[model samples]
Target: MNIQDKLSPTAKEIPPSGIRKFFDLVVATEGVISLGVGEPDFITPWHIRESSIHSLEKGITSYTSNAGLLELREEISKYLETGFSLKYSPQNELMVTVGASEAIDIALRALVSSGDEVLVVEPAYVSYSPCVILAGGTPVSVPTFQKDDFKLMPDALESKITAKTKAIIMCFPNNPTGAIMEKEDLEKIAKIIDKHDLIVISDEVYAELTYGKRHVSIASLPGMKDRTINIGGLSKSFAMTGWRIGYVAAHPEIIGAMLKIHQYTILCAPIMGQVAALEAMKNGHNEMKKMIEQYDQRRRLIVKGFQEMGLSCHTPKGAFYAFPSIQATGYDDHVFAEELLKETKVAVVPGSVFGEGGKGFIRCSYATSYSKISEALERIEKFVTPRLNGTCDKVI
Candidate 1:
């Protein structure tokens, strides 16, 4: 029997995450200062972790309801309303997922059918297109450019639509670029969405991390609440990545379909994680604010560092990434990333892995410590300065 023949074609066709490839590479190499992965370097807040520990101490080990602990669902509902002015019923319209990642997967699985096309904003999270493919849908890339601060233009979105377009998956305070859409910008896209009658899977995992302006949920727009699936989690905001807790809010019909899939596939999110998430919703804001402040400082530092080194970099409005163009180095993204890692022992992700519009850039994460970010910047400068100055010798 050929083992390869027994696997689903889609599962086989799914490529490994390019981010993970570099992440693993950094792990294998000693003394490398990595700014590649998007994960926050902070430990989970003490109060949230304590809540989970208390739950486990009480032997609350059994599964909750399929949709999750009703208390958690209620907290999520309240959080969404308070944070983004979106209301969802805990009983029928909300679900606790293992993470925003799972929320995204089940949303696509629930909404898309074979032969359907789902519009994905390019330079997108690495998981979106693959998850759409896994759900048996065609993943259509709707490109957004650096010149636009990576915002998805209404015209660009409208151009990707067809009768077969079932939905769109969008991440705001986007990964790799950290681009955020303001309220008016969202209104424009929301109008286009309404005109096309398209469903939106709005992944606002970084909603709390926006700087300078608040994140506007497209679902909050008039007539959009019914058609959008809102996804978010405790990972980025509460520094709870290991907890794997997230949720989806939508119309009860859509939630019911997603719940059915969640029931069969996940049964319930981990009880401890759900407990942590509930605490996060209720009291994690203070800790999140402190972390976000530090990230903002580092974001400015890294962006300035790249600019001083003669790399064209956009100031990220949210999230913890700095995307700088390496086009002047006469290297494609992969070559630049690999050469930087080899020469400086400083790892960053090549932009090509993110999709079409990312080819000339590289993503450096500012989620690590400020000192490490500064050191990495110095190392990168040392490595790139000679090349930028048209010299071939090492200065140090």
Candidate 2:
């Protein structure tokens, strides 16, 4: 049997995520402190967890409506309206998915036809390119620079557009980089999108984790709601990754199309997750506030620690990751990450794993306890200082 022939070309061609490979290595080793994966260490809030248990106790364990439990969607609608100032009808404009992962996949599958191009700003979340490719769309990576604080510039986006360009995946409060697109920046992208009439798959999964400012959805911009599919989840903001609940709010037509694919593929998001998400919508704001405050303090400490060690770090405005430049260490990102794990026993992801413009940086997630971060910092300083001073021949 020709197994290779049976595999889809896209599946065969897509490389494994670089971040996961290093993570596998680190996880297998003893005594390695990981800041590699972008996940909050906190447990899902007690009330949300209790809601799921309550649902199960009530025998509400069956499959939900294809579009999700209507009640959950209604709660989500109200939550989005209250939190992000975005409004949409729960009945027609929303669909719950297994997670933001599925929301991303469904949106791309619905909007992108064969050979259509979807622009992704790099260093992006790992899933965007593969999701676009799997949908038979070409992933056009627009490299955003550190000097620009990784913001997506309108001119850069405009230059990448072609007749085949169908959509743009906007990842703000971004993973690995922690850069959030401010309102003015979002307005610039909105202007470009308006000119091209391009659809937007806005991933706002990290919206609630912003440091000092409120997260502004691109969908909130003028003329954007109709063209934007807002993707969000309970994963980052509410520490609900294992709960596996996510949703999309878009124009009814787009939501309908995504719902069709989701119906056939996923049927419904987990019943328990839906119940939990509904509870989260009702009572998670205060929890989000507390977690954000903790993350803000850790965000500052980690950024400061990296700077104090003479590594230049982008002071992240959102998310709990710090992307620090490794150029001063005289090692490429992969080499630095590998050596750091082996020598210091502290694991972080190489930025290049995210995409271009990440070659000389590494992403350190500050989602763990402050003590863990402090220990990691100590090991990092010991490992890096000698390397920078030329006392160490090589990192490993």
Question: What is candidate 2's lDDT per residue for 130-176, written digit by digit as tens?
Answer: 98989988999988878888888877899999999999997898887
Per-model TM-score versus the true fold: 0.97, 0.97
TM-score, model 2 to reference:
0.97
Q: Which segments of candidate 2 are over 4 A away from where they belong?
A: none
* Over 4 Å off, model 1: 392-396
Model 1 lowest lDDT segment of ten: 387-396
lDDT of 1: 0.92
Q: Rate the local accuracy (lDDT) of all candidates.
A: 0.92, 0.90
How many backbone overlaps does candidate 2 show?
0
How would you encode candidate 1's per-residue C-alpha lDDT over 1-396 as one tens digit per residue?
Answer: 999999998889899999999999999999999999999999999999999999999999998999999999998888889989999999999999999999999999999999999999989999999999999999999999989999999899999999999899999989979999998899999988888889999999999998899888888999999999999988999999999999999999999999999999999999999988888888988999999999999999999999999999999998889999987777778878888898899999999899988998999999999999999999999888887777854221
On lDDT, the leading prediction is 1
